[model samples]
Target: MKKIIALLFGALLLLADTEFAEPKPSIDNPRKIVFPITHGDDESINHVLSSANNVMKFYGPEKVMIAIICYSKGIRTLLKKEKKIAARVRSLMTYDVEFIACGNTMRTKNIKKEDLIEGVEIVTAGIVELVERDLKGWIYIRP
Candidate 1:
């Protein structure tokens, strides 16, 4: 009976190890991602939205965090009249995506702080934010 109990215990240990085998890709945690949109065109905005959707699908919303920096002409994509893109932005926000706009651009373009559409945050400098994200190894896409 003693020998039998030892064999069973060893087998249980082996099974436990196999059941909790390490994951592939060897990641310590989910990767970081950032996208900068510098174009106000509808097509370009849609492209960024699509890319973000793909990332969320693969990584799961909670596992990945995305920051979209809008500066220059791209700030128009956050306007209330951008209905199509606005809807897409709303959908992405449900998954915790963040939209950042450049405060300097708003001043230069004479766009009021209140003029930005819902779900957008005004940042001090869009370019600086982009650079900081890049340094942290977040994937950068200009769409």
Candidate 2:
């Protein structure tokens, strides 16, 4: 029984150390990930940003393509007024993370392009962008 238990433990450790599957993320065949932020609260925003950073660290920036889509109240994350959070977003952008804001949300909130952080891209609808990216095989993660 002890031998069997020891073997199982070894197997578990081996599995934990197993490498990622074929096509194995690379600059050309990068893992595509999209993170959607729909809540404006600082906690939620920070959580999502942390999640993205963790992923980037695990995969190495060169092996992954990351996009963050913000809409509704979440649009606040991309606003210049967000200050600290906006700075964090800009820091991630330095590693090539793409940040997108919903145009509809801007119209509803009466926010203008100049109101957002310098590099955020504007999309007509954040949800639609999520859907299209999902269809194109991008992994969608909501943290």
Q: What overall lDDT goes with each candidate model?
A: 0.81, 0.96
Clashes of each: 0, 0
Which portions of model 2 miss their true places by more than 4 Å?
1-15
**Tens digit of per-residue lDDT, candidate 1, span 34-64:** 9888888888888888998997787677667
Q: How many clashing residue pairs are found in candidate 1?
A: 0
For model 2, the local distance difference test gives 0.96
Q: Give the best candidate by TM-score.
A: 2
| C-alpha RMSD between model 2 and the true structure | 3.2
- List runs of model 1 lying over 4 Å from the truth: 1-28
